[model samples]
Target chain A: MRKVAVIGAGMTLFRRRLLETGKEMCFQAVQMALEEAGLELKDVDAVVSGSAPDAFDGVHMKGEYLLDGAGGVRKPYMRVFTGGGTACFSPIAGWWHVASGLADVVLVVNEEKMSSITPHPQYAFANIWDPILDRPLKPNLVWIFAMEMNRYMTVYGIEKADIARVAVKNKRNAVDHPAAQLADPNITVDDVLNSEVMAWPVQRLDISPPSDGASALVLASEDVARQVSETPVWISGVGWCIDSTMWTNRDLSFPEYLARAAQQAYGMAKIENPRKEVDVVEPYDPFDYKELHHLEGLLLADKGEAPILTREGVTQRDGELPTCPSGGLMGVGNPIAATMGIKTGEIYWQLAGKAGRRQVPGSPQVGVCQAWGDLMQFSSVMVMRA
Target chain B: MVGEEYRRWEGDMEALYVYTAGVAGDRFFREIRDNERLMGTYCPECDVTYLPPRLYCETCFSELNEWEEIPNKGRVDAITVAYVDDKGERLARPKVLAMVRFLGANGGLIHVVDLPEEDVYRGMEVEVVYLPRGLRKGSFLDILHFKAI
Candidate 1:
């Protein structure tokens, strides 16, 4: 297979409600990415569109609805949905488009218009349960996540303040991100602890806000990337894994699927020691606690020890291993699939030395980004190098 | 061995969706409700006019900038008679639905036909019938139905 690299990336401002339609948002992001790569729609050979659920957009066949703006017209176009994992999985698909020699240049666009859902976007999760079992109980995402958080805290003897620190770090880091929606430079742990409680241990501040936005990336083969970009970030590794849908049957404290996915990516990237070899990390953090949980899953920290690392400033922007320096979903906004802008997109910028204010102190040469989705069962990992 | 405990379980799901007419859709629906006219977007690159006006052309991916009022007259491209409603309940009377295509348009609209099933033919010409302006809301409902012209 041929090597693939990210030549350009772009994202729209993360917001709760944007006046622009999904098609218009996609067009804006795609336009920015094409300009950044110094390429046009006519140069792209294939297009990959990613979105979370059709219910969020209130439109059936959403991919087809937003295709024209994504520059998929008269091209080999495909839509991929793996819940939130589409954030990274779409880029993985784009990688294959170039690696398989099917296309020399590929564009991946991910969009989510959660604001289109009335009442609350969480209402869309009500339909994602097992009709015969879970649906009868009327389980929403927060209620289940609360249960998982409680279990993790109970088993690990972790403190709420330790979990709250993740929120403080990410939100503070987001102050530098131009597209962030919830960036708070002065947010504190006490504020998080004092925030309104939605479920038992889950507070309003602990969760990321649902947002409407779109993100795009341009990927090209090694030779084409070298020709288009002076500092192309190579996609050296990709991995994805999904566990059983019966979430009740698994241990909530640790995500085994994420560990497996990360292992696959680390293996392909030939990094024997993630702690020492990886310079930067961006793990999905829809909830503050998830950042720590995903850190353990990615083997960046020992199981149940991520909170300790967070407290010691090991995960800070200038710490030994900076994590979520783009502010992540917690500090930024969670538009589900559109978070590709932060996860993969941020890593590309970091490795390319273009992160400006949010850039880690060290000139990071290798980075890893991961996204989790689908009833707490799906995870996708990607490793990139400058 | 079969057990009575393994029988079927029934459940109901509750989901609500509020759809926006979008940039192009708002303009199209507003024209029908306010002026009693049908509008379509023209794509010069593809030389095609799209009904239910879109923001971009599907064939060439060009941003559609030209807007034109399309004549309501069109021929029935396809017709279907429904005796049952969405919930599978028998309707008071059989309803006729037709896909009407306009001249110089790439896509068509599917709506209820005012004519009876016997009178609705595959190539019969029809025109849009709008509700009174006082009762019209900026929605597809503003166009009451299609009638034989």
Candidate 2:
């Protein structure tokens, strides 16, 4: 297998309602990525695309529908989806394309158009349930997150304020992101606490907004990458793993799926101590507590130590190890696929010394991007170095 | 994994659906059943067309232009076989779900197959199977399945 490097990254504005269709959203992102890498559609050898659910875009066979927009028309294009974790796994698929020597340059793209659904985007989540067991309960998507948040709070004795602090940090970070849609800093723990209770332990503000957007990354072999850009971010390790869909049967206090994936990634990257080896961390944060949940999974902090690290500002931009410096999903908009792109993209920019104002205080040598999705069914981890 | 099966009591009954509004959807499935054809929208600004239809073009950030008929004869993109139902029960039988690249179309659809499961292959040619007249509905299942030519 050859070494793979990310040469470029691009995305569309994360919005609540975009006039564009899913495929077009894909094109916008893919085109930008290619242009950034000084490549063209013809240069891509394969395409990899992903989306959370066809339910969100109101289209089945979504990957096929998104083919041409992703520049896969007649190429070897395949879509990979792991519900929400798809945002991260999609890029891993691209990494493999170049790594396997089957494709010299791979185009990775993902999109979620939640606006097409009426009333509430939550209605589309009615599909994630088990038709025979859980669906009968008519549960909304928020219920699952709420239950998990409650479990975390109970197990770690973490207060809602500590979790709310993530929302504060990410949203503030989004203020510097160009495509951010929810970059509101006026948010307070009281505001989050006072927000409408969609479910127990989860208020409206503790969650990411239902958004429509797309993101893309251009990945190439080390040879192609060196020719495209002077500073290419090398993919040191890539790992994706899945747990059973029986989310209700397990303890929701920690993401075991994430732990397993991180183990594989860290093992591949040859990192004995992740806290010291990884300078930046981008753990998924679809919900506020999730950031903390994944922090533990990433071993940035011990199982129950995320709350304390977060409370002490240790996870801030200038802290010991900056996490979600790009404002994360909570602040940037939860477009599912785009969040993962931002995580990986931030590492690219940071490595290239081009993150502008959001850059960490130093030239971080290594960074990690992790995401969780499905009914806690999947987790994907990737570690990159400059 | 196959041959082994289990049937435990499932608590309640629930159904999943993907809903869409505006004329794009209404016409999307409508044309498939009415004309036994597949269609997509073209974005004049981006110079790319779409399948599964859309009300707006995401690239140029403009509303989609008129619909264009795409051939229903393309290569098989990917496929998977299912031996279980939504209840996680192994079907007494197995079924094939395929993603076919319709002719002259940018995207394809996922549907059941009329061919024997063992005979199917990726990159094989296939065409849409329209509902016989009088059975038409403005839903995705309208086409029923795509069959080998």
Candidate 3:
């Protein structure tokens, strides 16, 4: 396959309620990315739009509704949704558009308007469960995730404080993010521990707020990229995997789906030791413990040892393996599919040396970003290089 | 076990949504409700006027910063007579629905046309009959219907 490179990236402010519609947000993000790449809509050959669910935006056939704003008018446009995994999966779809030589330039847009859902966006998750087996239980995401967190803690003998440290580090790192919604520089572990408990062991502070936002990335063939950008970050590898829907039957402590996804990406990227070779990482962290859990799943740390890395400050922005330097979903806010801004977007910025204040200490060449979604069943991984 | 009868369970998806009109829609609807005027966004590059006032041009994908006041008069591009309500119940009077396209605009608005079935024809000019100012809300409902001009 031919090589693809990310030439531009854009993101809107992560907020609880944005006055702009999903189409408007997509337009703003696509405009920024086009401006950054010094390209026009006519230059785009195809478009890949991503959003978590139709319920969140309150619009059916959301991809078609959002296509015009994403500059997909009269173009090859397709929508991909894999729960929250669409953040990175959409970019992967853009990669194939370029790699397969069907398109020279592709724009990938991910948008979410979670605020449109009344009461709370979490209410949308109720429909995601199986009608016969899962829906009857009236289980919400926080309740299910609480059980997952409790399992991980019980299996590893981990402290809540250790998991809270990820929140502290990411929120602190978000202080430098211009579009972050929850940046708290002086936040402490005690603040998280003392926060209101939504579910046992899962406090309100540990969760990222549902947000309204859109993110865009411009992917181009190597030739077009080299012609347009002097510092194009090549998408060296991409991988995604999803496990069965029966989440109750599996081990919640470790994400086997993420591990398999990471292996596929690593195998293509040809990096044997992720801990040493990967310069920066952006693991999905809608919940604080998911960050550590993803780290182990990515094989960046040994099983149950991810919390140790956090305790020693290994995942800090300036640490040995800086993770979520864009403050991740925890600090920057979680807009579901729109989190492509911090996941793959942050990785591209870091590898291109354009992360500004949120930049890691050393010059990083390779970065790996992962997004988890579905009923703890989906993971999408992308490996990028400067 | 293979010959056992299957039982089915019933459930309802209790999902509710509150959609905002967004930036352009807010401005467009506000103009209609407050000033009784229709607004359209113009793209100089594409030389296209977008009805419903989109923030950007769909063709050229350029930001449409230019706003123009469109006359609340248009010609019916398409018409359909609906005999049933949304729930498929029969209605006493058929609703005249038409896609009204404004002159010099790239898109049109689809709404009910308050005209007799015999009078409603494609290309027939129609003018918007808005609700009274006191009853106007910043929404499409503010325009009661289009009447034959």
Q: Residue-wise lDDT of candidate 1 within A1-386, one digit each (tens)?
A: 89999999999999998867898788878888888899988889999999998988888899999888788988999999999999999999999999999999999999999988878987787877777787777677798889989989899999999999999999999999999999999999999999999997999889999999999999999889989899899999999999999888998999999999999999998989998999999999999999999999999999899999999999999999999999999988999999999999999999999998998987999999999998889999999999
Per-residue CA lDDT of model 3 for B10-119, tens digit only, reads: 98767678889998999999999999999999999978898989998888888888999998789999989999999999999999999999988878999998877888
| C-alpha-based local distance difference test score of model 2 | 0.82
Q: Which regions of candidate 3 fall more than 4 Å away from where they truly are?
A: B1-6
Arrange candidates by TM-score, highest first: which order? 3, 1, 2
Error (Å) of candidate 1 at residue B54 is 1.6
TM-score of chain A of 1: 0.99
Candidate 3 chain A: worst-modelled 10 consecutive residues by lDDT = A133-142
TM-score for all models, in order of appearance: 0.91, 0.76, 0.98
C-alpha lDDT values of all predictions: 0.91, 0.82, 0.93
i-RMSD per candidate, Å: 2.5, 6.3, 0.9
**Of the candidates numbered 1 and 2, which has the greater TM-score value?**
1
Model 2 residue runs over 4 Å out of place are B1-149
lDDT of 2 by residue, B1-149 (tens): 36668766555323343344335766787787678777898887777777877655543335576789988676678888999999999998798989887655556688888877888999888888788868977678778788888
Return whichever of 2 and 3 wins on TM-score: 3
Give one digit per residue, the lDDT tens place, for model 2 in A124-197. Answer: 77767787787777778788888888998998898888888888888888898898989986777778888888
DockQ score for candidate 3 = 0.79
| Winner on TM-score (1 vs 3) | 3
Q: What tier of docking accuracy does candidate 2 attain?
A: incorrect
Best-first order by DockQ: 3, 1, 2
